[model samples]
Target: MNFKELRDLFIREGAEFYNQEEASALFYRTLDQLLGWSRTKAVTSLDKYIEASDLPKYLEVLEKLKSGQPIQYIFQETWFYGFPFKVNSGVLIPRPETEELVHWIIETLKGQNGGSLLDIGTGSGCIAVALKKSLDGFQVSALDVSVDALEVAQYNAAMNKVVVNFIEADILAYSGTESFDLIVSNPPYIKEDEKPKMHENVLAHEPHRALFVSSENPLIFYKAIADFALVHLNPQGLLFFEINEYLGKETVEMLELKGFKRVTLKSDMQGKDRMVSCSI
Candidate 1:
């Protein structure tokens, strides 16, 4: 079928799986990308017939969607910070809230001079690449525990034409030689008990290690990162985290207890307390 027919079919048959608007958007976006057709052109040619050979690909995508797989995974890439980033089962899909976190760091470090910046859990290297791209004057490096995630991150760094030093090490177990001017992380802040509360799209497709923290120790990564920063960050250097909305106050408190000064908690566009920044 043509673009309009496929979208209509998706909306009707996939209503139980996705809302009308979501299904419509996913179907059209997928069609545009798979067929390399402009939306305007596809709209005007709604009545045109699609080839029989393309039907299998359409049906396969629909089946995956019906099973609650995220469309970004099907596409194998996502746009973040206005750049195309490769993603897969090994990494979490970039979120709008995280983009806000990256923007905050970019603004915070723009005028600062010749100091190294470290990004923890740099899945897909979206934040690290974006920061280096925006602030060419600063030294940027990123580390991840998963080698698979680092491979994708490295590819993304190359794809974006940004220089980000990538390290394959768990931040929890890492011992490095250098100190940083800034340390930023968007770690696995979701507690295990909160998994059932998440959308099927996330729980079903995203990497568990990249999305979860133990319910018994919700601040595990945060505590480790904060302690690491206390020793690894220069005096007056900043520590930033994209936090779980439920634990904003606790995160800020943790940072303060680590001897960080000027702790600040900020909300994202949805007004949830999603970011916390502090200085050593």
Candidate 2:
């Protein structure tokens, strides 16, 4: 089939699960991934025939997309903070909001010569790797509980040619003696009841441990990380979190009660309270 035929196939098939615009976008993205064609090229070469070998791969991707599997998982890769990282069902796909959080950290430490930073629950190691790549002379460490997730994270770090210390430990039970100049986390903050509001692809493909918390105790990870920061942060060290938009006030209050000073809640591009930064 030619490019137009392939595009028509994807749009028609993908429309069952997504709107026209999304389906079209998915078609172009698939073409880019499978054929290495830019959108401009795809448009200009609409009559170009898809190789027989490549057609089956496109069909398989369409089937998965129809099944509500995210394209990132279909390709086993994603771009974050302008850097590509490997992803799978074993780890959460890094979101654009998390990129804002990374940019925030980079901006805050822009002039600093060097400092140690820890990324808790570093699924895919996007934040740790991105920060390490951006910051010169900074020692970066990432901790995750899942061996599968850690393996992916480690591979991503090496793929990006950055060294990040990966630790396999549950943050709740971790008792490391190391201290850091800055600590950041984008831990699971979605309440159990909120799952129904999320897209089926995310709920189905993303790791639950990296996306959810009990509704009764939605801030569980935040509290634990805050307590850990209180003990392990250097004097006046900084702490940052990519938080749930709905629980910003409660999170800020909890941090304040825990003796974190200068607690500042910030919103993402969407104007929702999605990040917080503080120092102790």
Candidate 3:
């Protein structure tokens, strides 16, 4: 079948489960993966016909989508902060909001001397790796409790050709011997009570431990990190977090209680308060 025919087939068969546009896009994305073609190349070359043997793979992917698997997982890779990163069930997928957080970190630290930087809960090492790639003369370390997540993160670090110190330790329980010039985290902040309100795409596909905090203490990671920063961050060092949009005020308060100065809460592109930066 030609590209146009396969696109039509996906839309006709899976359009009810996935929207027309999304189903169509999925078709092209899968074809691009199989053929290693750019989108423009793939679409403009519609006259090229697909082999009969490739039909089964296309149908299989469509059925998986019908069952609600995320397209990124289906593709087994995703682009984050303009870098290609591998992802799977072991780690939470890198998100656009988190990209904004990374962008904010880069912009905030612009023209500044780079020293030691640490990322807590460094799933896939996205934040740590992105920072190391963007900043000069910076020492970067990333920590995560899950060994499996760390493995994926290390692979991503190597793939991106950026060196990041990957440490396996629970940030909450870690004893720090070295102070850092900057510390950043995008820790679990979604409260259990708020889970029902989140989209199924997130609650179902993403790792829950990376998404949620106990309802009794929605600010657990924030408090832990703040306390750590108080003792482990160098004087005049900065702390950054990608916060729960619903609890920006609480995050700011947590930093203030820890005596972090110049606490600033910033909104993401959607105008939700999603990040906080504070200085010691």
Candidate 4:
């Protein structure tokens, strides 16, 4: 089939799932991936014919999308902060809010030198790798409780061409002796009760191990990371968290009660409270 025919078919088949524009974009992106051609190339060569064998491959991907699987996982990759990272069901896809948190950290530590940072529960190592990439002469290390998640994170670090120390240890039961100048985490803060409120695409495709907490202890990861930061963070070292929107104030209060100085909660682009930064 020719590109035009395939495009028309995709628009018709995808109409039930996505709008016309959305389906067009998805089709072009998928075509770019399968054919390794840019959108401009795909367009200028619209009359080019697709192989008979390749038609089934495109159909299968469309069916998966119709089934609610995220396109990033379908491609086994995603771009974050302008860097490409591999992804899968084993790790949560990096969110835009998390990118904002990384930006805030970068802005806060601009012109710093050789400061060590520890990323707890670093599922995809997006934060850790981005920080290391932006900050010069900075030391960055990340730890995750899951071996599968750690594998994905390690792959991301390598793909981004940044060095990040990866450790396998659960924060709830693990104790840290190594000190860091900055400690950061975007831990599992989504409460179990909130599951019904989340999109099925997320719950179905993303790793729950990296996403949820019991309602009774939604702040469990934060508390554990904060406690460790109290001792392991250097004097006045900063601690950053990408927190749940509903728990912003509570998270700040927890940090303040822990004697962290200058506890501050920040909102995302959509004006929702989604981040917390404080000092030990």
Q: Best candidate per lDDT, number?
A: 2
Candidate 2, residue 217: the lDDT equals 96
Residue-level lDDT of model 4, residues 1-280, one tens digit each, is: 8998888887888776678898888889998889898999888887988889778999998898777788899999888888888888999999999999999999999888778999998887888998889999988899998898899989889888888888899998888678999999999989999999987778888999899999998999999999999989999899999999999889989999999999989999999999999997
Candidate 2 matches the true fold with a TM-score of 0.98
- lDDT of candidate 4 at residue 110, scale 0 to 100: 86
Clashing pairs in 2: none
Candidate 1 collision pairs: none
- Tell me the tens digit of each residue's lDDT in model 2 across 109-220: 9999999999999999999999999999999999999999999999999999999999999999998999999999999999999988999888888999899999999999
**Per-model TM-score versus the true fold:** 0.96, 0.98, 0.94, 0.94
Model 2, stretches more than 4 Å misplaced?
none
lDDT of 4: 0.90
Model 3: per-residue Cα lDDT at residue 76: 76
Q: How does each model score on lDDT?
A: 0.89, 0.94, 0.88, 0.90
Q: Assess candidate 4 and give its TM-score to the true structure.
A: 0.94
Q: Candidate 1: where is the Cα deviation over 4 Å?
A: none
Worst 10 residues of 3 by lDDT: 10-19
